[model samples]
Target: MNFSEHFLHFIWKFRLYKTLDLFCVAGEQLRILNPGISNTDAGPDFNQAKLSIGGTYWIGDVEIHLKSSDWLVHGHQQDPAYDAVILHVVHEHDQPIYRKDGSQIPVLVLKNLYPEHLLDHYHQLVNSIHKFPCEKQIGEIEAVVVNGFLSRMMVERLEQKSALVLDKLSRLTGDWESAFYCFMAKSFGFKVNEIPFELLASALPLQVLRKHLDHPLQVEALVFGQAGFLSGSFKDEYPRKLKKEYAFLKKKYGLKPIGVGAWRFLRMRPQNFPTLRLAQFSALVLKSDRLFSKILEIEELSDLIKLLAELPVNPYWIKHYHFQKETKEVKLQLGISSVHHLIINAICLFLFSYGKYADQPQLISRAIKFLELIPPENNTIIGWYKSSGLIVESAFFSQAVLQLNKYYCAQKKCLNCGIGIKILNK
Candidate 1:
């Protein structure tokens, strides 16, 4: 079975390789004092390693490869980054390697050093065709271990989202409110039209919208106009008025509308149309003042749910999903599931990002607690985890499982995953 370089890194980092009676290619006795830190960035695989070669202490970095020739294949022989690599660990020692300073690096072949069973287990995992490589054995793991892993994965998920939020904040020049608006708008579009909504938010800043918050119609006009929805002529009085209002606002703000093709409507439910989503968003903007600040003050999950749920879209949307398209009159209120999604993906992430930016730990704690209070999401990914004997109690675990499946399992980063490590060690 073909194995990745990460597999070798995993064995050496965990000391799964045979430690006793180890020797270098030059017949020198080798003993590991410390394996050192694993570097994910450039240069050495492991840095600041401590090892004793022939009873003499050596302090430097450690480089690992499938073969000794790979060192030269990767151009580390000429690069100064490998000059500090005191030991070259490989599965097969095919050639000798020298540092840039013309000094020889010690080679240790690990092909026969580690247990064959460990390699067999890893091969089965990486080479498997199942949805999860270890799906068959996942149920055998202890509940406490699984729970601990999920908890850590949840934080990992949060950090991954936080990176996006921080990047947006940086681009907005620390404008947290604008960043929040962009995230919220994206969530409003859900997955189908998220990009177009984000583009709309970026084109029309919250500062410009605040000037017309007193008039919900003008707010709707601004959003719908910037989204390129009001560009076409409409027979309906409400849309015609919005078109006129948007014409004035567009010229006043010097706003440029995104491409009309950006918003998608094919195969989408009527309620999820970009037009309805913009209407609902306009309602939210009208109802709330300093929306991000208000979100930061919300501690209870019920309050947040009610806050998002009670938003009323423009009356015209009550009977129409789009301009001049009449549907049966119904409450155009945001659905419970949609609200929950916004709270999970948008509000919670914003709160966590705010806490990080403002150095407020309580806000961070509240954000996590808020996730725990929400119900687990029902989706194909979460369904897969449940079928695999993983019990998802709340949104926290579900989010963690989602992150694990998408980032770790799908990418085949088994050696880096806790569940994969457990299976390999077992």
Candidate 2:
């Protein structure tokens, strides 16, 4: 049977093969006291293993391959890293292997010891054309197992998002406030104009905006101007005022705006237009005094929501979604759903990142607690997981499902998934 090295890894990791009695191809009895921890980096496949071969106890690393000759194929003979290897585990012992000192290495063959059904089930799941590898068998898993795995996946997702935040913080010389500002701007763009919003934030730093925060119009002018919307002629008086204000501010700050073409409005609702988002973002900047500090003090979900809620947008945006276009009058405040999105994507990510870097476990606990308080996001990808019999009632679960879908299901990494492991083990 043809199988991937990953499949072989699974067999070795779980000791899926029979273990009553084992022997090496060199005619010596073998007993595994411990298979050791699996290594993901360079060198050995498993590290710090303990074994008894021919009544001699040994403790070192174990290297695995499809065949014994693969040891030489991988060029391990001359490398010093492999010198500590105490055993060679192979599916087929086609040839002998030796250490750099020219001493023979003991080999164990596992071609027949493992159950064939396990391989069959693994192949069936990975080779399937379904949306998820174990979509069909997922229903059979107990809720406890499913929830446990999702809980893990949720934390993994948070860690992954936190990594981006931490990277930004590092680049800013550990400036948490600036990192939060950039990420918050990106979240305001809501995926469509994310890149442009990020660029706008970079061009106009938080310190520059902070100086003008006492004057709401100047704050709006800086954000709008840096976004590339303040340039060119406008038919409306509001934009003309902003254009004049921006011209002075741009020269004062020596700022260069991103290209106007970076913003996208195609297939987007008027309320969600980039212009409206920038307007709301400007209002948020003015209202959110020491925003990162305020976020750090927030304990309750309601307080966090209140902090991000119902900013008094400028009167100019009350009847307009663009610079020169007028539409029906609309309340220009963030919706509850949009606020929840900000909490999930920006607030939680920063909290988690800060907790990890600053060594505050309480902050991390609060970050996760905030997710539990929010409702699940309504998106097509989430709806599909709900249809698959998965409970996705909170952003916590929804984030987990998104992570599982993107990292495990989409990539067909069933062997590394808890759900897949449960299905295959059964």
Query: Best lDDT goes to which candidate?
Result: 1
TM per prediction = 0.96, 0.97
Clashes of each: 0, 0
The whole-model C-alpha lDDT of candidate 2 against the native structure comes to 0.89
Where does model 2 exceed 4 Å of error? none
- Could you give me the TM-score of model 2 versus the true structure? 0.97
Q: Which lDDT values do the candidates have, in the order given?
A: 0.89, 0.89
- What TM-score should be assigned to candidate 1? 0.96
lDDT per residue, candidate 1, 1-426, as tens digits?
A: 288789999999999987899999999899999998999999999999999998899999999999999987888867788889989999999998887667788999998888899989998988889888778888888888888888999998888899999999999999888899999999988989999988999899999999998888899889899998888888989999999999999999999999989889999778888888888899999999799989888878899999999886878888887889888876688888899899999998888877887899898899899889889999998888789888899898899999989888888888998888988999
Predicted candidate 2 versus true structure: per-residue lDDT over 202-235, tens digit per residue: 9989989989878888888888888888778998
What's the residue-level lDDT of 149 in candidate 1?
86
